[model samples]
Target: MVQILLSLSIFFTSAAQAAEKAGMPQLDPTTWFPQVFWLLITFGFLYLIVEKIVFPRLSDSIEQRNDHVSDNIDEANSIKDQAEKKYQEYLSLISNSKKEAQDLINANKQSLQSNFDNKKKEIDKKLEEKMKEVSKEIDDFKKSAAGKIGSISTEVAKELVKTVSKIDTNNASASSIVEEVSKKYLKGLN
Candidate 1:
């Protein structure tokens, strides 16, 4: 700051000395070479400072800022790619779990169906055997009842004849008559 003030003071004192006899120092032929010499010196000094120091510092700061931004962008892209890959892996895991669950459910369904079919077949076989046993017992009971019914009918016929007709009846004749009637009426039932 002091150097700039001193330079300005010297410039004004020189201009003031030339102004004693001129309309403008810059337009005066006697001061023109000295003014041009000082102007070139100041301009060259400022040009060298900007080119060697100020411009290089500004460019270096700009390059550093640009490199920092580029690195941040690269890191952000890498994180995004990793997130996408994890999402795909999550989707695949869910799909695989669903498939495994479905397979297990289907296997259990088939197992239950097979067990049910086997149990049903076993019950049906047992019921058929029981039905055959009951039917055979019924047939045996009917045959025994039929044999007893003939003798019972003969005795009932002899008593009915003796009481109502007032006559003595024989067992042999009653038996024969019962047998004949039973054969005619009960032939198709057996």
Candidate 2:
């Protein structure tokens, strides 16, 4: 296959050479050089326009777009960083606030406990004082009642003795004896 393709390529090239030799006009160097120079100039101009004007503009636009994208990415990153910082600060503040609140609650509990203790102590003291006052009042009442009963008993005894003896009830001797006995009984009670 390669030999066949090579033979065909040779045959076609020979036929093209024969045709050129038979019919093509000979080009003079002076005339052909000028045409070549013009072609080179035109191609150079087109290449300059493409390279210096069109290609540069396209490249600048691409660069601007890339820079804009990069700047946007950087700004987004900065924003994300700021958000993270704010979040951390907020968390710290909340933690501090919670600690402070816990401390305040503990302090309040202690204060309330102290107040309750003080109140209990005051109440206990007041109860003791009331008990003492009540006991004193009861003792005073007992003494007054005993004194009244003693006086009544002495008067009844004296009346009975006077009635039984049928002597002058108002005699000085009888009165003196009754007074002495009453004094002895009252002293014994004391």
Best by lDDT: 1
Put down candidate 2 lDDT per residue, 81-137, tens digits, no spaces.
Answer: 999999999999999999999999999999999999999999999999999999999
Q: Candidate 1's residue-wise lDDT over 37-94, tens digit each? A: 9999999999999999999999999999999999999999999999999999999999
Please give me the total number of clashing residue pairs in predicted model 2. Answer: 0
* Model 2: lowest-lDDT 10 consecutive positions: 167-176
lDDT at position 187, candidate 1: 81
User: What is candidate 1's TM-score against the reference?
Assistant: 0.75
List TM-scores for all candidates, in order. 0.75, 0.51
